[model samples]
Structure formats: C-alpha cells, structure tokens
Target: MTPAARLSAAIDLIDIIDAQRIPAAKALKEWGTAHRYAGSGDRAAISGLIWDVLRRQSSAAWLMEDDSARARLLGMLRLERDMDVATIAALCDGGRFAPDTLTDGERAALTSRTLDAAPAHVAGDYPEWLDPYLAKAFGDDRAAEATAMASRAPLDLRVNTLKGKREKILPRLSHLGAVETPWSPLGLRIALGADARNPGVHSEEDFIKGAIEVQDEGSQLAALFSAAKPGEQVIDLCAGAGGKTLALAAMMGGKGRLIATDHDKRQLAPIHERLSRAGVHNCEVRTPRGEADALSDIKASADLVLIDAPCTGTGTWRRNPDAKWRMRPGALEVRLKDQAEVLDRAAPLVKPGGRIAYITCSVLPDENGDQVRAFVARHPEFSVQPPEQTASVLWDKAEDFAKAALQSDEGWLMTPRRTGTDGFFVSVLRKL
Candidate 1:
C-alpha cells in the first residue's frame, strides 16, 4: 500500500474509534476486515500510524491546532517522525486513497511558525485532570517522564527457568538480534523491527516448549520482588492468567503450594492451559465461590501473598497508547476503591512475619506509593519492609539488587524513564 493509503486507513480507524468508543485494536481489526485487499505490511504501517498518533495525541493536537485523526497524523509526521512539510504536502496531494488534501489552516499551522514551546499539559501528553497527580508523583521531571512513556518501548522477554536458562534460549533467538538486558540477568531486549507484534521468538519451538515467556523486563523485575522460595506456600491474589505465577513457579522450582486465585473465573480459565504448556505442576487455580467464601480457610497461611492489583494501567501507555485517552477522572475513583478493597481482603492471607507485595502497573500515586502508605496506616500490624532486604532475596544481579533497595518513605516507584522498563510500583510489607 502507498503511504497515502496507509494514512487513509488510519483516518478511518480513528474515526471509528472516536464515534463508537471502541478500543483502537478493535477499530483497526474491523477496518482491516473491511479492507482485505491490504496486505500484512499495509496493516502494520496503518496500525503503527494509529498508535503513534495516539501516544502523542496531546502534543499532536497542539501542533496541528486540530484533533482530527488526519491532523494528528500530519502533526506526528512533521514533528515526531521529522517528515518535512513538503513531503507531507506531496503525500496529501490528490493521490490514490490518500486523506483529503490538507486544509488551509492545517497547512498554515504546519509551515508558518515554529512549535518551539508546548504548554506543560500538551507536552506531558496527559489529561488536565491528571496534572496535580503527575506533579506529585514526578515532582520536577514530570514532563520528561511522561515524554519517555509517550515514546515507543522495546520488546522484552523473560527466560522461563522451568524450561531453560537465558544462555540456552539466547542462541535460538540470535537471528532476531536479541541482546541481554544490561540490568536484568533474566531479560532479553529485542531490537525493534518492522513487525512489533509478531512475537517472532515467542512462536519458536523453544518458547512453545516453555523455554521463554513474553513478559516485559519491568514485569519480570516485579515478579522477582516476590522472592518465593521452594517449598513455601504462596498466593498470587488477583492473578490474571498467571504471568507472575509462572515466574513464581519457576522461582519455587515447581515445588510447594502456589495457589493462583482471582475473582473472575473467565480470566483464570486460561491458566490451566498455560500451566500445561509451561509444564507447571504444584500450582492450583481457585475461583472465588463468593468474595467472602473464597480463601476463608487460608487466612494467615501463606508465606508470601502477592496482590498484583488492578489499576489505571498508566505505566503501560507505551504499549497500549489508547488506554490513556480512554481513561477518565471519574473512573479512577472507582479503581482506587476497588484496589483498597482488594488490599484489605488479601492482607489477612499473609502469615505473621511473612511479606505481602503490593504491586501496580500504574504511575499514579493514588494507585501506587500513596496506596501503600494508606495500607500501612490502616493496618498497624503491617510495616513497610526494607526494599534492600527484599531485593537481596529476589535478584542475583548486584546492580539491580542495589537499585531496587533504595528506601522510600512509603515504597519504591519504578518508572520507565529511570528503570528502562515499564512503570511499576512495588511495596513489600511485613506483619509484625
């Protein structure tokens, strides 16, 4: 497909997304089905355009003085991708399946003046409602932090020790130019290529045979925070499909009791299949009979209880850019309430002197550092565990262990900007 046709497809998908309030992935899938003539490359290019536009939508809108899909794409081309105005104009000219010619105002906005200064709100790519929260979380570097999140992320995978070590899988993935992540011994960072979603290495026999799992380096780091030992009982509360559960299983050498439970049965249903695929035994899946009845017998029984709680997913905007735009201020309140409830319910499952790890893939303080602080305050028996001690138990890499141990008044915040991984916040707490 011509560049022009790709632009047209992006416009169509964006329009559908705006009108139907559907996810960008759903909109793109529907658009692709309707345009079956487009090949794989065409779909990839169009999807890239849509995602890039969404990631920098605030800045793109500010640059173009319009928020239309075409305007956003044009702005992204000129500013983000560094496409010259002449090139964009040439593409917009009456070409086959191109977007309609650029409007007079859009052309003027593109060429007339320098967009040297964007307001903090636009540059941050965050909604106005989130400014206070972001400021509190990031302090002085909020813009830089948010800009980093707005940028594209690398493909990271964790080696499944249950099947093989990183050394074993590295040779198999060499064709894709996989490199060991500098900080994470268990992580491999793949060089970005044209096919971002292909999961090329994951489709290989090694991956299918439980040699590796597609997990973000940051998420792998969070799973390591648990430090589950062999023959110890652990509970992955709110374990959605058990990504961390698999990591924990490998950590435990597939021994001991590892119960993966979630309130939603539909989400837990796939864990059985994944467990089979990964050759994971000694893991059990539990669906809540009712919130009250589920795990009633297990209170204060677990050596480790990990609450991978649900949040706004603000930290993962690099991978799922559309979620930021879909998130509303009102919805965040609902999420905070749910998180508190989950924390309250899961806290009792940890044995005295055992640790409970509170985790979220959110950058917002309300869901992360602040949440941990509130939990400690409400439950006097629990106190924040020293991250250094937790890190020592979790990581083999000396540098990662040192970095992860930094003390915070409440807990640690791992930003993509600082950690070169997805944004995550983990707080380890112990019952006195």
Candidate 2:
C-alpha cells in the first residue's frame, strides 16, 4: 500500500477509537480483519501512524487548531515524523487512495505553528487533568518530563546470569546494534526508529537457549534494589508474567526459595514456560484457588517481599501511549485502592527485620511517595530504608545515581527525563 493510503487508514481508525471509546489495538485489529488485502507491512505502517497520533495527540491538536483526525495525523507528521510542509503535501496530494489536498489553512498552520505559547498539557502531549499530579512530581520541569514520556522507547533486554555473563551475550547480539544500558548491568538496549520493525530476537539461538529476557532497564533496576541474595527466601507478591520473578531468580542464583504468585491466575500463564526456559529450579509457582489463600502455608518466612504494585502506568506511556488517553480519574482511585490492599498483604509475609521493596511504574505522588508514607503510617513497625543503602548495589555510581533520581524521605523516583528510564519509584521498608 502507498504511504498516503496507510495514513488515510490510520485517520479512519482513530475516528473509530474516539467514537466507540475502544482501545487502539482493538480498532486496529478490526480494521485488519476487514481489510485482508492489506499486507503485514501495510498494517504495521498504519498502526505506527495511529500510535504516533496517540502519543502526539495534544500537541498536534494544539498545532493544527483542530482536533479532527486528519489534522492530528497531519500535524504529527510535522512534529513526530519531522516532515516539512512540502513533504507532507506530496503525500496528501488528491489521488486514488490518497488523502485530499492540503487546505490553505492547514498549510499556513503547519508552516507557522509552534509550541512556544502552548500550555503545559499541549507541550507535553499529556492529558490536561494530569497537570497537577505532574507538577507535584516534577515541579516546573513537568512538561519536559512528560515530553520524554511521550517519545518512543528503546528495546531493553536483561541478560540471564543463570545462563551467561553480560560480556558473553553482548557480543552475540551485536549484529542488532545492542549496547549496554547505563543503569542496569544486566541490561542491553536496541534503539528503534519510528517505523522500524523489531529484530526477531526470539528466533536467535541465545534467546532460544534462555540467555536473555526482554525486560525494561527500569524494571531491572527495581528488582536490583531489592538485593535478593542466594539462600534467602523471597516472595514476589505480584509477579505478573515473571519479569521480576526471573530477575529475582537470577539474583538468587538458584540457591534461595523464590515463590511467585499473583491474585490473578491468568497473568501467571506465561510464567511457567519462562521459568522453565530460563532453567530456573529453586522457584515455585502458586496459583490462587477459589477464594482461598495461595500463601497460607508460608507465614513470616520471607527475607524479602517485592511488590511491583498495580498502577496507572504513567511511566510506561512512551510504550503504551493509548493507555494514557484511556485512563480516567476513577482509574487512579481504583489503582490506589489495589496498591494499598497489596501492600497490606505483603506486611504479614515478611519476617522480623525482613525488607519489602515497594515499586510502581507510576510517576504520580499519590501512588509513589504518598502511598509509601501511608503504608509506613499504618505499620509503625516498618521504616523506610535510606536511599544510600538502596543505591549501594550500584557501587561506585551510587552517589551519582542518588543525585540523579528524586530522593524523598519515602524513596527514590526515576523518570525518563531524570534517569533515562521508564517512570519508576522504588523504596525499601524494613520490619522492625
């Protein structure tokens, strides 16, 4: 399909998304099913355009002076794709299967519009309702921070220490232009362009042999903060597809007992194959049953309890842009409730002097600092560990990392603009 035709399809898809209030993925899927003539390349191109429009929604609308699908897509071509007016006009030329010719208004707007006078929400391309929350987290730099979150994310992978060393695996993936991540020693990164298809790492021998797992550097750092050690019992309270579970397994080096369980069993389906593929044996999987406790047998035995709490995922907007727009005020309330409930569940499982690593992908203070403070308030026996101790695992870079991240009395916050990572807040709480 022509690039122009792809753009037209994307515009139509966005209208369906806005009208039906459905997810972008669902709309894209339905479009694909109906248009079977569109090949994989055409579908990918259309989906990429739709995602970019979602990411650049607010800014594009502000630039074009219109919120219509065509205006947003056209403005995104200028802002995100870096297409000049002439370049954009060439693609939009009125023809069979192409968008209509650019209007004098669109051409003039594209040539003259700039974000200098735009509001924070427009400049940052985030929902307006989140401005206050972002202000609390970033102060005057909220726009810059949110702008970073709106950009494309690099692909990050974790080297499984259980199978191979970083240097060993690094050379094998070099053909894909892999580089070591700045923050995570176990992480390798692959930079992706706007329309680039992902390299088929799953087909690689190293991946098939379970030498690496696709995990974000932020997540790797979050798990590292827990400092899980060999022969130590660790409980990953919300394992979700075992991303952190595998990281914990690598940290334990097959000596400690790692039990991974989540309240939802469907989320655990992918974990067994992942654990088996990674050659992990010391870990156990406990699926929850009908209204029964999965961790009933284990009481006050965990040396460390890791809660990768459920969140609004503001930190992951660069990768999941559609979620940011779909999120509402009530969603934040629901996540807060879920987060508190999970924190309460983790308290009893920790033995005396054991630590609970509280982590969230949200940059919102209500979910990060406020949540941690509230948890400590309810459990007077628990106290937040110092930022220095949490950064100790970072070794010589500890002080620099401490300086780079936002350190509050509750914990440290990492953002794309601050630490070059997804939005993550991690704090360690020790039971007295």
Candidate 3:
C-alpha cells in the first residue's frame, strides 16, 4: 500500500480506538482481520502510523489546532516522521485511497504551528492528570523526560547465561545489528525505527535455542541490582510471566533454589515453558490455590525476595503509548494499594541480612521512593541500601551508571532521557 493509503487506515483505526475506549493493539488487530487483503508490510506500516499518532496524540492535536483523528495523522507526520508541509500535502492530495487533501487552514497550521507555547502535558503527550506526578518525579525536566519516553524504544534482549555467555552468543545475533547495551553486561540492543517491523528474532536459532530472551535493559539492570547469588535461596514474589525470574536464574547460575509464584495462577501459566526454554533447572513454579499460602514452606528463609511490584507503567510509554491516554487517576490509587500489599508480602519472606529488591516500571514517586519509605516505616527491621552499593555490580562502569541514573538515598531511577532505557525504579532493602 502507498504511504498515503496507510495514513487513511491509521486515521480510521484511531477513531475506533477513541470511540470504543479500547487499546490500539486490539483495534489494530481487528482492523487487520477485517481487511485480509492488506499484506504484512501494509499492516505493519498502518500499525506504525496508528502508534505514532497515539504517542504524539496530545502534542499533535495542539500543533494542528484540532483534535480530530485526521488532524492527528497530519500533525504526527510533521512531528514524529519529520515530514515537511509540502511532503505531507502531496500524500493527502485527494488521490484514490488517500486521505483528503489538506484544507488551507490545515496547511497553514502545519506550516506555522510550534509547540513552544503548548502546556507540558501536551508537549509531553501524557495525560494532564499526571502532570503533578511527573513534575514531582522529574521537576522542571519532566517534559523532556516524558518526551523521551514518547519516542520509539529499542528491542533489548538479555543473553541467557544458563545456555551460553553473552560474548559467545553476541556474534549469533549480529545479523540483526545487535549491540551490547550500555548498562547491562548481558544485554544486546537492536535499534528500532519509528515505523520498522521487529526482526524475526523469535525465529532465530539463538532465541529458539534459549540463548536470548527479550527484556528491556532497565529490567535487566533491575534484576542485576537485586544481586541474587548462586546457592542463595531467592523468592520471586510476583514472578508473573517470569521475565525477571529467568534473569535471576541466570544470575544464580542455576545453583540456588529459586521459587517463583504469583497471586494469580493464570499469570504463571507461561512461566513453565519459558523456564524450560531457558534451560533453567534450579527454579520452581508455585501456583496459588484458594487460601493456601504458596510460600508457606519458605517463610523467613529466603536470601533475596524480588518484588517486580504492580504499578502504573509510566516508564513504558514508548512501548505502550495507548495505555497512558486511557489511564485514569483511579488506576494510580489502585496500583499504590497493590504495591504496598506486595512489598508487605515480601517482608516476611526475607531472612536477616537478606534483601528485598523492590522494582517498578514506573517513574511515579508514589510507586517508587514513596513506596520504599512507606515500606521501611512499616518494617523497622529493614534498612535501605545506598544506590551506590547496590549499583557497584557494574564494576568499572559503576560511576558512569550513577551519572546516567537519577540516584537518591532511596533508590535509582532510570529514564530514557538519562539512561536510554524505559523508566524503571529499583531499590534494595536489607533486613538488619
């Protein structure tokens, strides 16, 4: 399909998403199913257009002086794709299957509009209600930070040391232009363009042979800071689909007894296959049944309890832009309660001198530092680990890592603007 036709499809999909209050992924999939004749490339291109519009929805609307779906597509082309007014006008030249030709008002708006006077929320492309929270987290640079997250994310993959070393497996993925990630020694990153299709890495030999697993560099670092060692008992309190559990298993070198469990059994379903694929043997999956305690047998015995706590995924906006617009204030309140409960759940599981690694893919203070403080207050036995000591695992790059991340007495915050990673907050607290 021509680029112009793709734009038309994207605008239609955006309308469906706004009207039904459904996720862009769902809308895109339904549109694909209904339009079977659209080839894979066409679908991919259309999907990219829709996602770009969502990512820049607020800023684009402000630029075009209109909030309509068509205006979003036009403005997004200018802001995200960097298309000039004349180029965009040609695409919308009233051609068959293309969007209508731009009116004089649109042409003038696109040519003259600038975001200099736009509000922070609009410039950042985040929900207006989240301005205070973002401001608290990033201060005056909140708009810059949010704008970084509004861009495309690179595909980050962690080498499964359980199968092979990163150095050995690095060559295997080089065909996909994979490069070592800045912060994670075990991670390889593949840069993704704003509208490019993800390479078929899942079909690659390394991925199939369990040598690689797709994980954000921030997430890999979050697991790294946990500092799980071999022969040490670790409990992944909220393993979910076991992304971090797999990373911890590799860190443990398969020597420790790793217990993975979640509150929802359904969320644990994919973990077994993933664990098997990664060739992990020391890990065990425990599913909750009724009122029975899944970790009843290991209370007060764990050396490390990692809680990849549930929270607003503000940090992941680059990858899931549609979610930010759909997110509501009440959702943050719900996440705060869930995070508190999960932190409490991890408290008893850690033995003296053992640590609880609190992690969230969120930049919100209410979920990160604030939660850590609240947890420490409730559990006087635990002491917060300095960000320096926790990040010392980076060795030679430790100081550089510190410079890249927002460090505090509570924890480290990694953002795209600072660390070229999705927003992640990790704090390790020790039982004294």
TM-score of each: 0.93, 0.97, 0.98
Candidate 3 overall lDDT versus native? 0.93
Q: For model 3, which pairs clash? A: none
- Which candidate has the highest TM-score of all? 3
Tell me the tens digit of each residue's lDDT in model 3 across 314-416.
9999999988988999999999999999999888889999999999999999999999999999999999999999999999999999988999889999999
- lDDT measured at residue 331 in model 3 versus the true structure, 0 to 100: 96
147-200, model 1: which lDDT tens digit per residue? 778877888888888888899889889887788976666888885643355557
Model 2 ranges off by over 4 Å: none
How many residue pairs collide in each prediction? 0, 0, 0
The candidates, ranked best first by TM-score, are 3, 2, 1
Q: Candidate 1: which pairs clash?
A: none
For model 2 the local lDDT of residue 215 reads: 88
Q: Model-by-model lDDT, in order?
A: 0.81, 0.93, 0.93
For residues 1-432, what per-residue lDDT tens digits would candidate 2 score against the true structure? 998998888888989999998999999999999999999888888888998999999999999999999999999999988999999999999988899999999999999999889999889998899999999999889989998898888999999999999999999999999999998889999998887667799998989999999988999999999999999999999998999999999999999899999999999999999999999999999999999999998788899999999999999999999999888999999999999999999999999989999999999999999999999999988999997899799887788888888999988899888888999999999999
